[model samples]
Target: MGVYCSKKEVVEAQSSSFIYQRNRTTSLEEQIKARCPNSSANFEDENSHSTKHSSEGKMKCTKVCFICHERVRLDHSCTNQMVKDLEKHMDKDQLMDILMKIKQQVSKDEQSLVPYLHWGTNVALIFNPFTQGLQRTELARNIPEFSRTILARENRIFCIGGQDSSTMKSLPTIFEVDIEEHYRIKDKMNMNQARFHHTAVYDQKYDFIFVIGGMTSNSMGNQFKMLSSCEFYRVQQNEWSIMPNLKVARDTCAACLFDSQWVYVFGGRVQFEKRQLTNVIERAFFSRIDVSQWEEITLQGRQRIMPEFNVGMCHQVNDTELVIFGGKDTYNKQTREVLYFDTSSFSLIHRKSQAQSRKSSNVDEQLSQAKTLQKNYSTAQITVKDFRMPLEIEAPTSPFQIANNLFVLGWSKETNGIHLLRLSLINLNWKEELDFTSYLASDVD
Candidate 1:
């Protein structure tokens, strides 16, 4: 500058001087503390007075009302270090008004979200008949205890009451799996009783899972007994209540819901001290959420002995007929036969029919009433028919229906494998769907 340098040279000299100062080496920690003064307590106290006014300019805080549990945002600009000025300026009446508005807004938001939370899509566990295997679905993590019961409701499968794997005794543990969520297992409230080989049915109207008869051994394990007792699990409340005992104690019985008002239990073995097996069909009537009772119904005009001690598969064909398949006969030999029951016939025996009969008095009126009653009686007549399946299934499990196709899961002696048999509702023809040999092999390897 003293030599009268040009403006470009003067600028370059200043830039060089600044670069020399910045290039001087320093400790990493010292450099950090130098550049970030407020990051440490030493620099904080050093700059406290200088930065006091700037930091006190404005601060945002949250306030909550103890009376209504409502929260609101507040701001303060006072520089006084010793006092909270936001609460002092608040008016109780104004805050209460704001609280009411907030509550209304929250209620509206919840109303908008309710439908999506309550409405769930329908899902089913799909099995491919042609492939004879589950369709790329996740298997449940835990295997069921011996003689377990499986029930389906609202796209979730509830597995309840079975023999414990560790103790070889009955378990009260309840597990559920959501079919829509890759069959993920979830823990549920335990049942009041530990049991196995029980029957469970879902009541759609009341949203309850009725757990019926099952067997459990004594503490000594030397004697085995069947359970005539029954209980129901309330889905909404996650609670269980005792239902009226079955007319007869049963184990390994088939149960189904009829007309949404009755649970029909079929052919199960009753064990006495002498181990005698008795099979009977009973219907449980549901009148209210808290009350249900079972009554025996006669199977009229049947020639074949009712399958006793047989693990038969039962399915509701309609309001009128239910088809039962594959249980052992009284001879203790597995049979390849199908049985059909006319369920509507049982309604004719109800108290309503007796009331209708007592209402008619005059001869002409009685005659006309009899004619109409006869027509209704003819339609209500219970018919049981035994048909032979193409293949014999030993102790078939429950039958599941999709569309018009009826699928029965059972074991076949010819193939020596667990097979799924498909029966067409249209033609009543039987076809082999899947074998579990390959599925089991893959699981083992």
Candidate 2:
């Protein structure tokens, strides 16, 4: 009884011992590293290594031009500039001679041309905004390949793999396009199923592109059905293989490969269920089954993170933050507010925008305004220089949609534009309201 200590005291003593042991462990690790410089495998971030290797491979495509199908001189390649120059002088009469020679020389090359970046906001008021600022642009082209499913590849930004509404089934064609240059489409791979509303994400660990549950049909259909299978596309082998079916049937699901080891699939519609939104997190590990095996995670925030989203589109800004933005809600109205999810707890971030009057038809008249006007308000002839609408954007891409940056508001009624509320995540500030609605009259319905 005299030697006995309460549970709290005992626990505190153990905690102190654990802290001492941890410090010693850290100290030993540093001393050993210094003593035997290259002995330890030294746990490395595999993602960094993979990224370096990927970058190295990228530099090897010496002769391919990612833009305009033009002949570009790579750093070390040898080409006769005189020959190219003289061709410019050759007249249309001799054009056929030049064409044949160029065609013959180029035919020997096997690599396909890279797509260039194309951007257009339909009308003058619209502007191409994403880093992969491409222009197959139409308001109606809302069902983009990249945005549709995991439609993006590693180097490539977005591709077309998800379903097409016209066919009324999942698409068999796999379109791969680089995100940097959003100009053209890549070689299409025929998949086992046409997937629309499926989840697509690149697994660097396995060097494979995996597609999760989506809708499919034998032929086109009037109404759609959910798919329960998972498939993988081998970029190197240029082949397709089917994997184990999902534990649950999902359509319009969102997928992300975070921690370089886990692919989380969540928030999908289950078959004909009207309000079926799942909070299940399917963890596909980087082990042998990176191509297939999945286990459901019963994490604390599964329900909160997934929410009860009906029409939700989410993109991972990074490992820590996954921004779930715009999608038609139960009411069919698009969203502007976003939920920022992390390891500890969820935090709410709000967005705002501001505009100031700068010019007026009559500057003198504006200055002549009543003295009672607030200094911030202005004088006669003063005008709102920038009509920046202070609004919130939900999902942010770059330029049009900054890559994993700003907010993406589907359609902000206030500005009547597809709003991208601008502000640094570090310092929340409103930039400008991007109005795509003006362009919608022609394309987006």
- Highest-scoring model, lDDT: 1
> What are the root-mean-square deviations of the candidates from the true structure over C-alphas?
27.4, 22.2
Report the error of model 2 at residue 123, Å. 12
For residue 52, model 1's alpha carbon misses the true position, in angstroms, by 93
- Where's the lowest-lDDT run of ten residues in candidate 1? 111-120
Task: Give the Cα lDDT of each candidate.
Answer: 0.52, 0.43
Clashing residue pair totals per candidate (backbone < 3 A): 1, 40
Spell out the clash pairs found in candidate 1: 132-434
Q: What's model 2's overall lDDT?
A: 0.43
Please provide TM-scores, in order, for all candidate models, with all chains considered together.
Answer: 0.57, 0.48
* lDDT tens per residue, model 1, 58-88: 1111122223333211121111211123226
* Model 1 CA deviation exceeding 4 Å by range: 1-133, 136-141, 149-151, 180-182, 220-222, 272-275, 302-309, 346-386, 394-397, 443-445
